[model samples]
Each structure stands twice: as structure tokens, then as C-alpha cells.
Target: MAAAAAAAASPATAPCFPSTHCTRPALISLRFSRRVKVAASTDNPSPAFNSVTAFAPATVANLGPGFDFLGCAVADASLSLGDTVTATLDPSLPPGTVAIASITSPSRPSLATRLSRDPLRNCAGVGAIAALRALGVRSHAVSIHLTKGLPLGSGLGSSAASAAAAAKAVDALFGSRLPRDELVLAGLESEKAVSGFHADNIAPAILGGFVLIRSYDPFHLIPLSSPPALRLHFVLVTPDFEAPTSKMRAALPKQVAVQQHVRNSSQAAALVAAVLQGDAGVIGSAMSSDCIVEPTRAPLIPGMAAVKAAALEAGALGCTISGAGPTAVAVIEGEEKGDEVGRRMVEAFASVGKLKATYTVAQLDRVGARVIATSNLE
Candidate 1:
């Protein structure tokens, strides 16, 4: 197995956050696609065991123009608590067996307090169970734990991280039979329960790096062929407020101007090209070029303009509302710039009122999901 390095190369190109510019090709195009190339593939195998631990990264959904079709994994996401699944040694029971057990993140207790219960329903856990069920490993008892790092419903793909981690852990417990796409689908299904029927957050979280959800029929997902030499930094500012996903969706305008739509499409495509070619300048330009969602959502969040301005002034490539709103993200060059930009974003949020802002500095995660440990009761 390859030793874990500090970090892998850029997932695809030097693209600034997920931006949706163009309508995906009507037909799936696997040939000459730039989204399939990745610098790393962690596929070391292990025997089915009794317990496991998994970490899932936070993800940005509807990146700029990609709008549910595109997204990228951000490192340092929340850690879904943990789970232990193993076959119970009971001669009295039937030959085939299946059972599930869940544990809460020590940080918080009581399902009522949790935004989403049925931990198995969580994106990370759902992906894990879906993988196990697909493998046909029906005879086993499993236990799960969760670690909540990112705030749920903050548009940070918080639930996706939990689901991805749990899904990967379940795969390990069952001897890792499911393919990558299957796991991604599992997470997507879990996402449907809370955030309505559609969201691209789980796809990138499952596969890692950048993903373009080109289709749902047989799921035509492609990992972007990002430039390895590129390094994009970010400042994610999460404000202290819970903006229900349902309400946020209702705030969107159903109609848009024709010219605004055209500009958005053109700029979104430009963002993709910039990422593919590793041009920060072009990507940065695209970050502020949004004609579809941000304008309408901006008013819902306080201090949007000021916070974004601070991020830019602090050397950010571009800035925008992260995931939904309230949480804003700024794209930058590297760690130094990320730190500086993050500081500015926090300060920017203060002008609104007495609000707490969580400033996160992150990079594009290149690798998808994997199991750190696992166990199966057989």
C-alpha cells in the first residue's frame, strides 16, 4: 500500500469552487472527457472484521453553475461518529442474518436534538449500508458511531460526510464488494430524505475530488481530470444560524432574465476551462459571475456583500455563498492566503450583528471514500 502523504495532488483542474455554467452534454460523453483523471486511487484490501471507523469530507453542492451537476470535496470535513458491525456467534439463530446498531456522536445526544435521526439514513451511513446490501452480505450485525464536525444544514454537505464515511465503513465490513458509483448512489438516496429529491453533494463526497454528475440513469458520473500542479485554497465562513433546507429552496426565484441566464452559462463554462488549465485568474473571475442563484439568495443572508468583499480584499480568487447561504466561501491560492482570507471573512461577518462565524480553510480533496477499520460478525 502507498504511504499516506500530507495530501495528494489537485483532484482535477485549478477550478474555483463548483460553478455551473453550461448544460451538461445531452448524451453521456466518456470519450475525451477531462473529469475522469485523478492523481490518486486508494484501494488496498482488507479482511472483513468486527468494527470500523471512517472519515467523510465536507462538500459544496451546486458549485457556482454546475447546479447539482458538479461539485468538489473539501478536506477537513466532519467525522461521522463510528460503527462496529460483526456477525453474532449464535448457533440458535438462522444461517443468514442482518442487524443494525447505531451510536451517537459523543458531542451531542438524543435524536430529538439531532437535525436528522436514523443515523443509517445519514449520507455517510446510508452509503455504507447500501454498499453492504449490494454485496449481498445479509448475515451480520453491525454497530455505528458518528462524529459531527461540520454543522448540519449549513450547505457544507454535513450530512453527506456522515453518510459517505458510514457507507465506506460498511463496505469494509462486508469485504468491500460495492463499486464507487454504487456507494455514491447510496449517499444520494440518503440525501433525498432531508434536502428534497435532488442534490449533488453526496456524489463528490463519495468519490472524492471533483465530480460532474452528468446523468442519473446508470449515473453517468465523471471525476474531473484536474491539473496536478494546481492548489486552490478556500475560506468557508459559517454563520450561527440554521437555515432550513426546505425554506432555502422556497426562497429561490423560479424565473430569471434571458441575458442573465446567457451570461451565467458562458461564465460557468469558463470556470470549468480555468480549472482544467490551472488558471487561477480565470477561475477567480468566474466565482463572482453568477446569474442563477446567488443574487436571490444573497438578501436572505446578512452581510453578504461586505463579507465577500473582505475575502477578495484579503487575496481571495473569488467568493460566494457556500452551499446555501449564511456560510460564505472564498477561493484563494494556498495555505497562507487561505488563512489570511479566512480571517477577513470572519471579520466581514461581524458587521451584520452579534453572530458567531466559523472560519474554515480547506483544499480540494483528491481522494474519495475508504475505510480505516472494519469488523463483521459472521
Candidate 2:
């Protein structure tokens, strides 16, 4: 204790730490001895980390009224990716400069070697890696592995979640020299590659909460304040089916009816207001408030009306499409009703043949996406 106290009081006698390098903006620390430690504090500066790993959550984008502009986070859906730092010569790297060490799903088996492809594609691993390449960050090479827990293209922002997670992992692995906003931009770049257009789903996955992407001269995002009285809960139903995003986008009419457009826009504003006011009833009511595409696209998914009816009867606040469709999302006032809503949804599916569909009750996950681990420090 006396020796430690003396070392702490005496900077000259304390074990000398790295004070030469400041290439990366991120600060890191490593403990070398019982009485000596290496750190970059307010009085110390050192080289940043060289590697990292990221974990991002699946997102529900364009939730009903907020098409192409709004999104929310989910807890159950998640993805992870790992990488190698290229700025310095390090080990644990494969030959292709950057390589995918393993993949949890065989969804996109061939993408492991396609460096030019966007990492945000249907298979999350590929999309994340691709997004990194687009950032012109070849100075760092990454070996990644992605876990696909969310339903792909089932109206859940699976690609966005994967891309954001991968982007975060890459940044952290490299000592997080990139700014928070820039890291989000990099995630969006990956999403664009797979979705073929830019949206805010991936950005807020890193930032958290409900985000509104205002595509103005100076692009900005507006996050709505969430209320505590309104308990967050959801009933997600995935039918024994799939709908490709490409097809669904093509189905949307480029030009909407003038009245319908106005109504949808109004509902979007109302929904945002409802959240701030802590009005669960209004929030659920607003879920059914979509007049733009739901009416036009409802028939695409079989047993839609019956499922919705069952969800409502089971005490759900509102019932609507999860993201695109096939998967229905139902809102509950509180978690107590969660099981009931789920059962009702399942019953509804049973009426049409239980073997044809499945549903689960979930909550509105406000935590957003984030990483769970790291590899090394520069």
C-alpha cells in the first residue's frame, strides 16, 4: 500500500506509459503491473485501440404512418461482427485483406469473398462488411461473423441492424477514431448498398430511440421523446411466408391520392405528438392511422383482417403490419396483455390453419442497437 501510494504521488517514479502516439482519436488503457498501469487520461495520451466487435439490434422502420422517415428499435433481433486492424501489422487476419471468419446462417453463402458487394444485403454479414469498404477504410482489414436473429426482409430492418452493428464494431476495433455522427453515416452507407436507397433506420440503431430523418438541405434527425406511462409492448406475427422488399417497394404507387397523402402526413404528426404526450390509447389508435399504403397493400398478405381482428379482441391497443408485411405487429398497453395478444394472434392464424403462421408478443425496445465485445487496443 505504501509503495502504491508513493508511486501514485510520484509521476516521475510511476511506471512510464506511452505518451508518444495520438493518431486515433479514441483513448485506451492497459494495466501492466500491480503498481503500474498504462492509460491515456486527461494528463496522458496514447495510441488508440486497433480492433473491436459490434452488436446491433433489428429495427422496425416506417412503422405504419412514418414511411421512409420513422423507425423504432427492437430487443429480440440482433447481429454481431468482428474485424482486424489494418493500420498496423497485426495477426488473426485472413488472406483477402479482409475476410469473414464465419457466418451463423447460410442465407448468403457466396458473399464471404465479394469485397465489392454491400454488407447490408439480405444476409447481414455481407452487408456490414460492404458498408465498411464503402467508407474507404481499407487501411483497416476486418474478419467478421454475423448472427442473423431477425426475420430477413419481413418488414424488420434486419439489414440496417446488421449494418449498424458491423459499422460500430469496425469503429471500436480501430480505436473509435471516427466521430459518432460519422460512424452513423458509415452505417447508413452500408444500408444504402443493400436497400438501394438511403434511410434513417441504421443511423438511429447506433444512436437509439425513435428517429425522424428530415431530408432537408442540411440533413438532420429528430428524436421523439418517449413517455413512461405508455408501456412498451408488441405482438409480432410472422406468417409461413416471405415478401421481398424489392417487390413490395415496386408495389407502392409512386404518386398517392392527394387526400390520402394529406391524411397520412397528418397521422405521422399525430403519432409523434401522441408519444410525447404519453397517450398510449392515442398511440395505438395512430397505428391504424396509416391511410397511404396499408389500404393498398393489405390484400398482399393473406388473412390480414382476421389476424387484426383477433389481435384487437385479445386486448391489443393496435394491430398493423410489422415493417413491410406478412409479419404483423400488434401493440399492447402494458406487458400484462402481451401474452393475451400473442395467443389471439396465434388463434387467428389457427383459424386459417395454425401450421401456416406464428406470432410472439414483444415490447417497444427503446434501447436501440449497440456492441457487446472488443478484441484489442492499439
lDDT of each: 0.59, 0.55
RMSD for all candidates, in order, please.
11.4, 13.6
Best by lDDT: 1
How does residue 184 of candidate 1 score in lDDT? 73
Which stretch of 10 consecutive residues in model 2 shows the poorest summed lDDT? 1-10
Off by over 4 Å in 1: 1-47, 77-125, 374-378
Clashes of each: 48, 12
Displacement of residue 173 (Cα, Å) in model 2 is 1.4
Q: Kindly list the per-residue Cα lDDT of model 2 for residues 1-378, writing each as its tens digit.
A: 001100111111222111110111111121122222212123221224554556666566776888778877656432222111122213444211234344453444443333212111222333334334333343334555555455455666666676676666655554555566666665664454445445557756766667787773466777776876667677777787766655566678889888988889898888788877877777777787788777656667777778888888878777777666667888777778877788778777667634377665556666555546554563
* TM-scores of all candidate predictions against the true structure: 0.77, 0.74
